[model samples]
Target: MRAPGAALEVALQAHPDDGFLLLRTARGAGGRPQDVEITWANPTALRLLGARVAPPCRASDAMPPDVVSQWVARYEKAVTGPGRSWTNGVHGSSGHDATGSLYSAAFFPADDGVVVHLRAASHVMSALARDALHDPLTDLPNRRLLDEYLGMALTRIARHRHPVGVLFCDVDNLKWVNDRLGHAAGDRLLRHVARRIRAAVRDEDFVARFGGDEFVVVVQDLPDLEAVSALAERVLAAVRGDLTLDAVSLHAGVSIGVAVATEAMTAAQVLSRADSALYRAKRQGRGRTRAFDTALSREVDRRLTLEADLRQAIERQELELAYQPLFDLSSDTLAGVEALIRWRHPSGTVRLPGSFLDVAEETGLIVPICEWVLATACTAARGWVPAAGPRFKLHLNHAACHLGDGQMTAHVQAALDSSGLDPGRVVVEVTESQVLTDFDEAHTALSALRALGVGVALDDFGTGYSSLTRLQRLPVDVVKLDGSFIEHLEHRDRDRDVVRSVIDLSHSLHAAVVGEGIETDDQQRVLRDLGCDLGQGFHLARPVGAAQVSAML
Candidate 1:
């Protein structure tokens, strides 16, 4: 009669899809299976084990360490039990499994010891699960897996009191490339970036694609903050280097925001801090690195709150125009007023434009806000005229963004027609810096205003890129010297010289020169000696509401 092993082997051969191996087990210390020997095996078992072996092969030699431990425990149970019955649901570990697989393992009683069987768990299902944790294009970890990795890293750091660093990377100008070169080119660029990042980092360091144009890296067991900074710089240099796509050379850069792991911080907290630093890096100018700090976080929060407040301020008509009187140096009398924007905040505090004007420009709210300023200034100018005496020129500061606006001319015309204020009484003042952004556009817009009988002044003249040649070419009627020159006119000879030269140049170009920020008697005398056409500052009169203008006049 055939032995039980032979009978089991014959039965296993009937199921070609499942693998079968007969193992001999020996008890060691603590009654555990210390050794496992392959006494017999079928062809299917040989393929599954990724091994070519005869009977009596050691289980440890054939499988991974983890798989061997599992097999030994099952072998002892099947061979030494009272019932000596077959048991199922044991699985092999990938530690020694060459197939890189999950298994449906079982053990059955045999003549010598026991028989082991394995059938690979659903291959398609396992692959699908893996795909979910990784990026399809770059094969790097996805955002979901990144969270898991970061959580585990944070836990390890907490226990060991070590540190982990997180680097948040954003690809700069990626949208421009995607729009100009096509999405296919953009995808290729991203794939190349992923490879470069992987090569630059250590083997154990984790990198992930945190969605479009963004990546996150986690460096474990950091020695110090300097090491974290060095890693960030290297990653930035690596991704920003030149690359080729479809035989065309291209370049891209990354802005990195760094956050070191803190003992009390959660995964979400760390991520948010890193994102705040990233925002700072982008704002300070791209292709830079910024570190997470309490101050930066607070500043970001304040800016966010201010942005919302400003949107409300515009809608609720909380914005008001403060008039700073301009004086004619020759007449020593009020010539006109500069309209300055002030925000009457909900907290009952008045805020200057420096606090929230940047937010307005970034959000495109400057368009509507500029329109309101023009209309309000024009309407207010009409109130002071004929009744108060002569028509005073109302000067309104203009940004380059206002000039390119399609509705700017119409807005100006409507303000003039509605207020019945002559265009000649309005002076649109633009800083030299603003005009340089699009000189041609500024020239065209200002020239159009001139045609409509409105005067254009080059504001903050000497502080910008405008030269005598360019200044002569611009269609302007006045040059407002920056406050710095007037402030230093008494102390610095260079400043006095610059002021005098500017006054002469403006006169030569048939444009009037206005000395700004005259706060002292000496500054006024110096500007007067320099023959400046107009002067405006707190020394003469601080910016006041419309009702206070009559008293100043």
Candidate 2:
């Protein structure tokens, strides 16, 4: 008869599946087998184990740490116990099959050790691969897969000379939903939106959940720009509606930005252009679509440069306050000044608030910039002596984003305390639409400021939708009529009626009225005749520096 080892090797070589022979080692401390040595392996097993090896090698040296531990325990039980067979689900971690494949490993007792067999689980591997590329929440392709698909589309564009369009979709008011409703509701809304977008697109198109509240769609073989626009419109229509979440009704909307591929553009460039157009759409107003154009590209570049420069404007002391004098129409004397922020660019050009305020608000630079304005204005007002009254008011415009938060009140208190300026002599100016955006939060914020003895002025009145009752309920001390109404005040009867009605209503509410943007003498005269209490416009005095304001006082 042949030897036991030689007989076993001959049988393993004839076996079709992967097989290994592990020999038992003497127990070190405990009354159990210490380890297993890899004494023999077939050709198939050698491939799985990474290389051909001689017998009498430790299993730890041949297999991964985790794999060795599992096999060693089985070897100990098979050799030390009642010589029973065992089977286990093991993960392959060696060279050739290291893609985290699941394998069924069987161990059977031999003369002095155990023989092992491994068979892969193909279905588990497929599921793992699928889960790697899909988002768990929406079951849509994730950013990683989106990038891969976008690359493929770009390649197809180059080869086939066909246009590929990319649509960047951003969900509007998702944050509001998340804040008011629960996160579960938000997740449900996202999943619903993903399904709708997928249903709205063509079968060939690819849709993915790019990130939080944002999705990207890749369309291949688009013929023209109009087709891309039509697709965007379809997506918008599909997402726009009332969604009832947990017994609460909410409106779902999305802003889409579209960009078509150029032969010279890279995948990143195309996506970036679409993102730029999406930003433009949001700025114009959400729930719309915008296409990328040459002009928009230039505008985006300019805005980016301005944003970068504005981030450094405050630190470099390039920012300064320009005081536009607010005059009392009754006495024909200076009553106070509205503090306007100016950016003295290093290029020797002075930039107005309109030129960069939007960027400031979007980038969240407005918070710090506004704090600086408050502090500087209060300090400058400390040196001014009123031309007629006990003390002239300092009107500072606050951004809408800064309102509805207690931080605004804290900023005002700190400014007054630091500058030693009287709180009663300070007026915080906010637009009408800002107050109406979230009336309750704005009310709470304004009430806190009022408790500090600071006055509130509703700037840009008549420009937004506000009812008489809403206006009456607001804690406003002064109502400044918008510049548009004053622009044609002398010619338009409707403008006159609006102004007269506002003045009357303001007086009834015990609030003062100031007509804004009085450019011509006729406009100022008409406003004064209509019983306007205060006036501010270029006709009276343009915005000037602190020294000029002091001289005027």
Candidate 3:
């Protein structure tokens, strides 16, 4: 057998990357082993002992007292007797101990002493393991690790009968930032967002980036929905705070969807529930948190059904338009008809535009649906023979999808050519919100339509950011006052004053004003007395089919 000192010397010389140490048993006065003395150590071992200590040192002299105690406890089992072969896994503190970097040590009995091998635990891990478990950008946990953590949380809940909550956070308008500033700004925004979220959650909570401006948080052992909601609100507030990246003043908000697992649920189901709630928050306008419930689930299921049906709705002839007569208050007669789209469901029920228009817009179905409405309305207008007042006009609403596609003029011209309706008598109505969202695009589209001799009317005019400055910037031929303005017009002076000012502004712009949702003669009289030009509502005439419209004419 090699001598004790020779064994340690050969091991230290051969294994330069790992720390090597030879520890001899030191006994007390009663011949009982009291502790182990570090008889010899390699340069790597001295380095692992930290720069504060020298080579000839004991375990207690080299490491923290607690770590030395742990090391002694672990080595006691290995060094039972002389020539007894034993081994143990051990840990010790290293010089670069910011996060408490640890060395994994294995001790083996050799030639009346213990031979110890030490390596940094971090280096012992494979690169694939690190990459798979951590996000490369933010160094937070990735989706794979998230799945594991969420699954374990769910399992714990099942065993302990507690609730597991999750918050799915989505960055709103990230695409806008990416398009406006640059992708580099967008990436920095995401990293800052990740840090903010990490700072918001508890030390025990886990956060993961689930790709593309989406993050998932695993909240374990939440007691009830209130606790879950409170945590979600905290997370939202943390994410919604001001952020500036790379000398660019950027504003971004997060919409969070929350779900809790109190019963038997798979991780995917919980995530899907949260995702569905996120859809609701985004649909209701962003920067809010929504919790998953039975009603939302039902609504989601119904929307899914409607979306599938709407894809084939046009081919099935399930779509048609109704005309509501717009009256010219000055002429005291029917002025124009607004085409409204309705869906004839297979269940023998009629669905209003509100029931499915949002779904249509989201699914890109609004494009073809608007085209169809334009063609049908032009055809009906061409067939109409106005015997009394001026030539009848056909008013149709333009979807933002149409404006954003930059094809509004081509679609309008095609409809006119196919139906032979005069472009001078056709009015394409767009809402103020659409203009606000994509100002340049909507402006270009509307300007091009006006150049084609088609009049452009601003629908729902007073609801959004419709300042006089913005209104004057738009090249509109008419402005339809939103229904809210006329809802309380009989009582509220504020409503009346707003309508009066808008009327004056529109007239000054040489554009006519139309009051929508005029449900009473009193409201109509008030609007006309306020100098409103034209009006359309249930009081004027409810939306009617082609035959009813022809009869009314």
Candidate 4:
């Protein structure tokens, strides 16, 4: 005690902003630190607390009603149980907002009673709270806090076997909101929407702000899907009402997707169904609610299973390439072939890319599948390359996400370099919409690949936004007419006109055009007449293996 007293003088001299007090106590709680007693209060405590010498010595005696009265038990447990601890609470002080931190140094055996070394820890208390559970601007529960509360709610509901529904809420036009109005207005809109939703739901319902205008509402003890849909209707009504934010009067819309938990499903599965429902809502038009459908969910589950199978298909030697010839317009000769991926199942039946490619792209299994296709096509097309005549390109379709990634250049480069095939024989076909984002990066990657003598084609043109703009910007050598635009061209003159314009536009940009999905003789004749450089479809020929391409060559 004598040694610590001498050191206390040095400690007080070196430190500022910190309130200090000497505490002593007797052992209690079975071999625990002694129950605390306060001996002296340093000048820092008085200054920090803004408390005058009011005759009482214990810091708790000066605490405010909101501080001690509200949170005494939780805070007290931390204070007296452990050796040293701290917490945030308000103090009874003027000139300040009464926020401060309290730390009990030690609970030691004392002559009279226990003492907790407390000072106004308002700043620390506020900081702890700010970090604990909120999104700064909206003051909504963040992901971390959401998980904590959800865990608690789950525990309670599980014991009672009560139902809980999770709704995945996303603002329908946040990007539009940001672009049209401004980020400041966007922030205000988000906060405003958050407040409205909180007010719309029952007090017992849990609302958490998941990232970027997305909120997850957990409605506890719900009975059925209809009840959840009703809540979604209330949310929709609240969000879609005309409102003003930052002096900009506009209507905001939201699409809510609801997933109700069942004994048959996992939490992740439930959440995924909600996400899918959300997508369905977006498709049906925003500002609507879509409840999770079992049939629709089964499709999703099947797709997920297919996605998992596809990732290993290449390594398992289950994936193979099937090429369909694209004939030249004027020459009536085979100009090139578009390589399509096929899954050769154990049952000896063939699986088309349409059945699995979307899932592959979504699950990020497309990259490796594309790699296998590239390598296999190059290896198998070696014979077809020489006799397939000049300008016989092996067009390979790549996913949009793969094209957008800067890392794709390396994968492509590696595939081409390792395949020991001439780069001129292979062409990377990407959709026009894929390169729209970060065009500079796409340009850089495409240019690097082109420098290696690889060709680039913008597949699925004339369907997405600014097709002509993309044609001009991209370093594309060809444009494949999207099948959606080309499908009904046999009789639809409007479709025929759009296709003709796209072909002419492609030629104008010094890029050749290929009309895909030409499934009838009339479509073929019209495309040939229009000078569509290359044509691919079930009408001309079905997708065949590389050996078949060699035989055709």
Report lDDT (CA) for all predictions: 0.81, 0.83, 0.82, 0.70
Winning model by lDDT: 2
The TM-scores, one per candidate, come to: 0.60, 0.77, 0.71, 0.68
Higher-lDDT candidate of 2 and 3: 2
Q: Write the per-residue lDDT of candidate 4 for residues 132-188, one digit (tens) a residue.
A: 888887887897887776566656655776666878888866765686678988887
Best by TM-score: 2
Q: Lowest-lDDT window of 10 residues in candidate 2?
A: 87-96
| TM-score (C-alpha, index-matched) for candidate 3 | 0.71
lDDT of 1 by residue, 99-152 (tens): 676556667776666777666666435667889999998899999999998998
Worst-scoring 10-residue span by lDDT in model 1: 88-97
The residue-by-residue lDDT of candidate 2 on 227-305, one tens digit each, is 9989999999999999999999989989999999867567788999999999999978799999998899899899889
* Cα misplacement distance, residue 276 of candidate 3 (Å): 1.8
Q: How many clashes (backbone N, Cα, C below 3 Å) per candidate?
A: 1, 0, 0, 17
Residue 327 shift from truth in candidate 3, angstroms: 2.2
3 or 4, greater by TM-score: 3
Regions of candidate 4 where Cα sits further than 4 Å from its true position: 1-130, 135-137, 152-162, 171-196, 199-202, 211-213, 221-223, 233-255, 262-273, 279-288, 432-453, 465-474, 483-495
Candidate 3 per-residue lDDT over residues 1-553, each given as its tens digit: 1233766667666665778777766544146444566777666766765734653456666667765666676567566645545333333323333246766677777675677777766655554588879999889999989888888888877679989999999998787778777999888888888988899899988999999999998897679877988998898898886677667676667999999999878889999999999988887889899999989989988988989999888899999999999998877688889999999999899999999998898788888998899999998888785542464678888777778676788889999999988899899999999998868777888999999999999999877866888899999999999999999898899999989999998999999999999999899999989999999999988999988877777
